[model samples]
Target: MSAPASPQELRKLIAASSWTGPTAGVLDGYQQANLAVVPRDLAFDFLLYCNRNPKPCPVVAVTDPGDPVIRLGRTEADLRTTLPRYRVWQRGELVAEPTDITAYWRDDSVGFLLGCSHTWEGPLRTAGVPVPHAADSMAPPVYVTDRPTHPAGRLSGPLVVSMRALPGHLVARAVEVTARYPTGHGAPVHIGDPAGLGIADLSTPDFGPPPRLEPGTVPMFWACGVTPQLVLPNSGAEYVITHYAGHMFIFDHHVDETP
Candidate 1:
């Protein structure tokens, strides 16, 4: 199928299950977000968690308790059906990956739209820094790191980062380009040495496929939206919800704009 031309159209396609895969590189100029829905009882702690760890869990739009439609930059996007895929968690364990969570939806569930690095791909490309995953039509590789997030009430765990192998020269341009977009996990957290982050092998990512790197390219790591997913197995929340590995929600806001 041809690509949906606008965020609303892409959302509609996702709602209808016509697109049930990673949302990377779609709706190029608009912002794509990682979804995190937790019971209202655990909302404050999670919100605090995002606030304390802005780099990895940057907040974009958050739905009020029980409200499915997002009202940040746009008012029409619904959390229940807007994302391509969703993951349901129980006692810190992921139990389901579904197209829609209407069956699990609760009136007290709060949805969070966290900033995603995919939102920075356009700027990177504009700066002459190639976005490898976008060029390959794949999701960037995400991995769990030894770096720990500050504990906020009930949530705390290792940081997760998405890896991008950059040409040695463009690494600086990539950093400069992404730094302007703070809400989208601005700049590189680590430019080389995956071992520094406790990542043993780039080939065995915790989520998504291993990256394809050229001979002279060096891996650069950026704070990833997958941080919450990594935290889930350790957070004590009775229930949690998130987007499946590479699946994300598209929002009407542009990358430079705060939602």
Candidate 2:
């Protein structure tokens, strides 16, 4: 496989449509974010939801209503066209999957950027933890769990998680590498058995592909960025916008080094 692109290079690649798949292997050192668009009226409550559930919904940045420019992360990045794809939601249902959101822009719309697992992938790989999905060029498997998150206003729902398989012996090292990047969903929430987290099967994921669990490997689960979308119904927002699974908003902020 080719060497991964740098963050800025990945941005250019994404802009040029040279890399339209997941941001997993691109941008080896920078942070990638999950997207959430809500009306200005419900921004506070959604922000509260993020604050209350840092594990699954770490708030990386927020955009002013009607402004597509993300000031806090990737100042030059436009929310309208930066990501490879977007998902449009109306009245709690997915209405469209588009690459650009310029058509949906509204004067009352606000954007929220949340931390994603891409931030931790590099560290894990460097430490020889073997992120199978990233290594094999596949998206991490995601599932909705039975665990409910703390509610804020109308925002409430079960937590969503992404899975990665690693050798049983290196599981602790995998946790150590990821624990250093707490903003990137931190460490695994559930390991070993998917059933422990109310997840019934590994072959069927709520999003992305089923994981290939190599012999001697154990499945590890981390809070997913998709958790926000799952919670959108409870948020009561009439409309919303988010990046497609594995497609993320590239940001300018440096990844946090502390746990």
Best model per lDDT? 1
lDDT of 1 by residue, 1-259 (tens): 6799888888889888898877777778788888899989889988999999999998888898998888875647778988888889988787999999988889999999888888888888887888877876787888989899898887888888889997788888888999988777999899898999999999899888877777999999999887887775567777888988668888887887765
> C-alpha displacement of 220 in model 2, angstroms?
1.4
Mark the 10 consecutive residues where model 2 has the least summed lDDT. Answer: 1-10
TM-score of each predicted structure versus truth: 0.93, 0.90
Off by over 4 Å in 2: 1-19, 253-259
Query: For candidate 1, which ten residues in a row score worst on lDDT?
Result: 229-238
lDDT of 2 by residue, 1-259 (tens): 3444455666666666666677776766577889998989888899998999999998878887888888763356778778888899888788899877899989998988888888988878788777777777687889999899898888888999988878778989988988888679998899988888899999999899877777887888999888888888555578988889888877665575321
Per-prediction backbone clash count: 0, 2
> Which ranges of candidate 1 are over 4 A from the true structure?
none
For all candidates in order, the CA lDDT equals: 0.85, 0.82
